[model samples]
Target: MFNMILRVTENPVRRTTARDIAIIAVFAAITAALGLLPAIYLPVSPVPITAQTFGVILAGAVVGGRRAGASQLLFLALVALGLPLLAGGRGGIGVFVSPTVGFLIAFPTVAGLIGWATERVGAPYRLLPGLVVNTAFGIGVMYLFGWVGMMATTHLAPWAAIVALAPFLIGDALKVVIATLTAKGVHASYPGLLRSRTARAVAGAA
Candidate 1:
């Protein structure tokens, strides 16, 4: 009984259908577009407050883990190949060495982690609970990566890095709220929004 239950609870094995690929690509583009929106650069750091993280959060709740991670990977790949997809029109391999690289590195993991959390939270995907989860894991994890990157690049002490990041938290908090609402709204209107092809296959197998 325990073994059987484990199979049912496992991450669904997703087959990458054409439609799935398209949806993933669309989210990647949406993230890139958000980066194109105006960024408010703060005096304290090179990183700016932008809407890209909103896209990241949405990808998690809407696309599920593996695909959401894939989308961010694709975005990063495009940027590395010298498309100015990042905010401020910055890109290229060199950008990977920038202070934001830590946060950039966390992109795939952050999306994947949030996706994992959303699935665990189950149906109806309540906003307050989702907000709590996103705050704890999604935003928290990214900031951890972000400040580490800042510390390395700027040669700041760990304590100073944390202090430097304070200004951006408020805007990021708003993004957490927006992301939760967007995902919840989609989930309400379209059941099985998080249903993976893997989940379908598992059902078929069962």
Candidate 2:
């Protein structure tokens, strides 16, 4: 019975080891820490510029889709639980109803999508394609959600929403560039950065 239990527990193909859970937790903590960075608030927009995007991109690039999404979910859970883990050290149930809430809720999806796109770039980690994917999908999608949320919450016209969100575009684009370069450097230094366990399993079989 003990042997059978060990086999069940240690079945690498069927389960994540404690190490994986711990690593995911660490990434979640990293995401939370990034949110603690100083925020620059725009007078016209409820969204504040923060380093959280950098963490979001890095988490996805390093952890792949499922784990990256898990990490983001964990971070959001912390915020939902009333931890001051959001930008400007703000958190709690109140944030859920705030204008920026849609963007907050979309974090996991954005990370997962970014991870999926980055994985398709294959080996050697070509910089440009990954950069473009991260920019177009990661930051762009986030802004879309945020803009809609702002309009909905503020009852602003589309043009007003666009004007309010415009200030963030250039800064966010710079963040995407930074995240892309960072991901490229990590991939070059650690060639296994983007490899999923499923890929490893298939490769080992072949």
Candidate 3:
């Protein structure tokens, strides 16, 4: 009976088209929900510290590069439509014009990059390695867009722009560490939960 149950649990027959859609939708909703968490306002800047970093990293780790990027793009689209879905319930096209806008635009690309990198690592998960890669790539993406956006939108000189961004750097690094650990934990617990595409390919072959 134990062997039979194991066979049933591992049955490839469980894979289905609807299942893939449902899984992706669920992860997308999770990403959005993480965005809605309360934020810590920074008096120095309009940018607020929020759990959205978790959402961003989770997208890459759980959904892989392509769907992860798609999920972030969907979230951005919602924001563009004037939904108060961003940090501190702020959103709209106007937000895109703000100094923090570059960070917003970098979200999808960072997710894709992290996802792609993690996939290349080819392991269950290693916290230090994941943390290092994610911290570098995620922060690099944010700063690249953020500095340019700040320079374009605000009166701050280059040094001031660097100063404005400096305060958030440590916090962002902490978030990256948290995200890396979270991803590793989820991966260990649910080995194949994120394999919707792979399952589909196998199902097609069968």
Candidate 4:
């Protein structure tokens, strides 16, 4: 029974389909577009508040884990290739080494984590569970990585660095709520867009 439970819960590895690639590419572009939104810079921290994280949340919630991560990775790859795809029109190799680098590094990772959690919440994406997963992964996990990145790059004390990031919490919280609602709508309309691996398997068997 225990083994059966594990099997039922497991996310089976599957090959990416062409449709997955198209969705990934579209989300990557959406991420870039969100970067074009005006960034609000705070005096306390070097990182600016932008709508990009909103894109990150949407990518993970709308698409499944692997594809969402791939989309974020693809967006970062474009940024690295000298496109000005970041907030305030910043990009290229230098941006990767900049103070915001840690947050940038967290992009793909957080998206993947968010997708994984969203999948665990299963289909129909309930409001509470969806919000909880998005908050935990999108804000909590993302901030952790960004905090570490800032300390390593700027040589700031840990407490001071995290303190500096306090201003971003409010905006990010709003993003979480908005993204969760948006995802819920998408899941309702599409129904099959964000299904868990187990859910997909069950559907196939049916």
Question: lDDT for each of the candidates?
Answer: 0.82, 0.79, 0.76, 0.85
| 16 Cα displacement, candidate 4 (Å) | 1.8
Candidate that scores best on lDDT: 4
Off by over 4 Å in 4: 1-14, 40-48, 196-206
Give the TM-score comparing model 3 with the true structure, all chains together. Answer: 0.76
Worst 10 residues of 1 by lDDT: 193-202
Q: Per the 3 Å backbone cut-off, how many clashing residue pairs does candidate 3 have?
A: 0
- Arranged by TM-score with the best first, the candidates are 4, 1, 2, 3
Per-prediction TM-score: 0.80, 0.79, 0.76, 0.82
lDDT of 4 at 189: 85
Off by over 4 Å in 3: 1-24, 40-48, 193-206
Could you say which candidate leads in TM-score?
4
In model 1, where do residues sit more than 4 Å from their true spots? 1-14, 40-48, 195-206
Scanning candidate 3 in windows of ten residues, the lowest lDDT window is: 9-18
Number of clashing pairs per prediction, in order? 2, 0, 0, 0
Q: Model 4, range 1-206, lDDT digits (tens) per residue?
A: 85885577456546876588789989999999998988877675565678998888888888978989999999999999999988778788998887668888888998898888887777767889888889998998899988998898899999989787777887798789988999888888888776556866688689
- In model 1, residue pairs whose N, Cα or C atoms come closer than 3 Å (at least 3 residues apart or on different chains), thus clashing, are 13-198, 14-198
Across residues 1-206, which tens digit of lDDT does each residue of candidate 2 receive? Answer: 85785577545545666667776788889988988878876665565678787888887776677778878888889888999987678889888888777688778888888877777666556678878878876788888888888888889998998887787776687778888888878877877766545665578679
* Model 3, span 1-206: residue lDDT tens: 85885566454544445455455556656766877877776666566678876788777876677667767877788789888877677788999888888888888888888878777664556788688778777787878888888988997898999988987876687688888888988889878634334555577679
Error (Å) of candidate 1 at residue 188 is 2.8
lDDT of 1 by residue, 160-181 (tens): 8888887778778878998899
